[model samples]
Target chain A: MSQELSDLDRRLINRLQDDLPLTQRPFASIAEELSLTEQEVVDKVRQLRDDGLLTRFGPFFDAEALGGAFCLCAMSVPEERFEDVLTKVNAHAEVAHNYQRDHALNMWFVMATETRGDIIRTAREIEHDTGLEVLMFPKKREYFVGFRVNA
Target chain B: MTLDPKDRAIIEATQAGLPLVLQPYTVVAETLGIAESELLERLENLKKNGVIRRIGAAPNHYRLGMTANGMTVWDVDDSLVDDLGDKIGALPFVTHCYRRPRALPMWPYNLFAMVHGASRDEVHAKRDRVAELLGDACRASDILFSTRILKKTGMRLRGQKG
Candidate 1:
């Protein structure tokens, strides 16, 4: 799964992390700035996504700002049943991001939904499915931190 | 911020992702049966109103050589967590930082900062720097490394109305 990326790919990856202009020809502006043709830029992005280098692309909607709610939930699954429990938990679309963290409460995930009430509802549903208590850590205050990876 | 039907449609269309084409917005606008200018204007407004954080690509950190992803949790004094959290969030290596309520007994940490590095040793070194910055203000801390990414689909608005 690991492959060496060219200098052009690295530079393009870094630039794409920043906000893409909201223009009719957004990729054109990016191509001009990166000194590449529009087709080259688009092709590289598509290639990156195809190769699993990039997860997803486009508008990152902040659920909270859009009247949606997000909650960080964790569960301690038995070692033997980890996979089974994961399948059941991930079945819900509300389970946005799930990570197997190294801790007593091993299974950590985030639930994003349209309403705060829905967060609890989905948690209950998961608990019923997996029979594990879901610990909810609703963010009280988010410190302004920009998330960017140096590729 | 209430979303009109058109706005919801736009989100539904692009939430998965924009098409990998030269004229991505034009494609999306056509799919939604609207003018390209209207789609661009609505997108700009969504960004201005904070609905959209950014329109860009999310590179896989692991693929980018950031293999170690640690969630550094700290039990900072409630009185000073805000001030200290602001400082920790500003740390160059810290990616996402937030202050959440602690679940008593089992979970006592309230401040969470995500740190990524090439290796666990590097992550530990960065964690040490965070400890130094926190000093005595942080009562106890722990680091949790993600063993695997079970799922990574980001926030999605369900098609059915709530």
Candidate 2:
């Protein structure tokens, strides 16, 4: 929470992840309901994005529907080679999230593929190219974890 | 209009708790006083327009026997991120991977991944595999197991009151 946002801002953000108003005057309709002008609503949304409070404002597609498989994976790299390994991991479009943590296994990321075979193939390729062991932990069961950041 | 009144109503209703029946659509249609065909058509349009991503179930993993779910973070090289991210994202078990701003003060990891398994040991074994794949660039990594599960649901359009 860097700076306090107006009530209208919060409401707009809450709706961003959901179905956006699918109308010619989507912003205006939402504004009317929230008792704010369309311009004001748009302005607030832009500000929220700029503030980094909103990671993304769009639909979260069902990966399974597309016949894609996803899971979490991580690896512990020597402190010296951290930068080189990071570049190698982020090059792939399937790698959605990558972060650093405070532990022996300091780096983690998520991977999704159209098929299980692809997931394995990609992991093996990375290991071959980087010459580091990539710990592949496929998700056996998925527990939804919703992350919300206040603006 | 991207979503009509009826379409909005349908989305609001089924955002969570999809009817658990063979003809869930029919039941939802009857409740909304719309024909099943009409409901299905609207949903199709929404999907085409990228409004509603998809209609599916979000199961409770813990109940399904996956007791351990951990967030694995990595510190990947900036130059290799795009290449490695694409390969990592292709993994079936590697769900939901994306680039995020790193946390400050001692934590400098840039790659993040998640794994779900029956037990903690299973997750650790998978971690070893990922480590083998990452090779020299991987400086360090760690897993933060979920201690508790909070509210889990589809997107909520109407903000909840405090």
Candidate 3:
């Protein structure tokens, strides 16, 4: 369901993905750079968000950096019980960003909690609830990758 | 880093998103009963500490025509995974690349890299580039395209203090 975007919108989307200036008049800089008024920049951002082209426009928090924990867990839910297991697993607030991937370990998701211990606790709870094994694939190391949309 | 009470308030206020306005910080600060300067200072500190990765906008890729999402997993030689992962991550097309412990017997993949494109063919073409880059270090690899989004509510902070 892709929709056509204006040339200006394309540039704005690409620029917004980068770090926004943290200032009282943050949009002022963006406006100056884009050769638009501050109000115009703000309005475009608002419109993009309102149109659902932008999911969020704010600080991206790192839970692990804030003393919380995040773990990538997967489970091979039986095809017949996928729906039931999904409901049970998604019921938890910690189960963030669950996806149904086409693989044996099909149901993959990331669990973010207030602490490291909470990761295991949630996994056990899901296993008990779903009657399936939750394989935790905690990141041993992360390679830096700058993610940006080429609007 | 431990978040102060005000920091927690700031997170709670803007976790979902910051207001879309000429001065979004002003509105958030006023709502939280803090001066704009103080709120900006705290936010600056949080960014420095890596608690806040960045202040930016996340585009809805699906709406932006990037409909294909592939999670490419590789069973690379343990000794070379890190070095290879660094290269893979640097490729502009690879969104996220990480080395995770392999759950042997069932799961033999240790490297996970996410690629997105306008179509599955485009994604696979990019995946082929990654495979070419890995050369002999990658023993076996597979890609898992997401069939559906079962859940996508990002991390939510508990109401009670930690």
- The TM-score values for the models, in the order shown, are 0.89, 0.47, 0.94
For each candidate, report its DockQ versus the true two-chain complex.
0.68, 0.03, 0.75
- Candidate 3 local lDDT, B1-162, one digit each (tens): 888888988988988999988999999999999999999999999999988999989999888988999999999998899899999999988888999999998889999999999999999999999999999999999999999999988676667664
Residues B14-45 of candidate 2: C-alpha lDDT, one tens digit per residue: 66544433345667779999987787778767
Name the lDDT value of residue B38 in candidate 3: 98
Off by over 4 Å in 1: A1-3, A80-93, A125-132, B160-162
Q: How accurate is candidate 3 locally (lDDT)?
A: 0.91
Residues B63-120 of candidate 1 have per-residue lDDT tens digits of 8888898999999999999998888898877888999999999999999999989899
- Report how far off residue A137 is in candidate 2 (Å): 22
Of the candidates numbered 1 and 2, which has the greater lDDT value? 1
Q: Write the per-residue lDDT of candidate 2 for residues A69-116, one digit (tens) a residue.
A: 666566777889887887887676666667665556566666776668
Model 3 residue A63 lDDT score:
71
Q: Which stretches of candidate 3 lie over 4 Å from their true place?
A: A1-3
DockQ-wise, the better of 2 and 3 is 3
**Ranking of models by lDDT:** 3, 1, 2
DockQ score of the complex predicted as candidate 3: 0.75
Per-structure clash totals for the candidates: 0, 93, 0
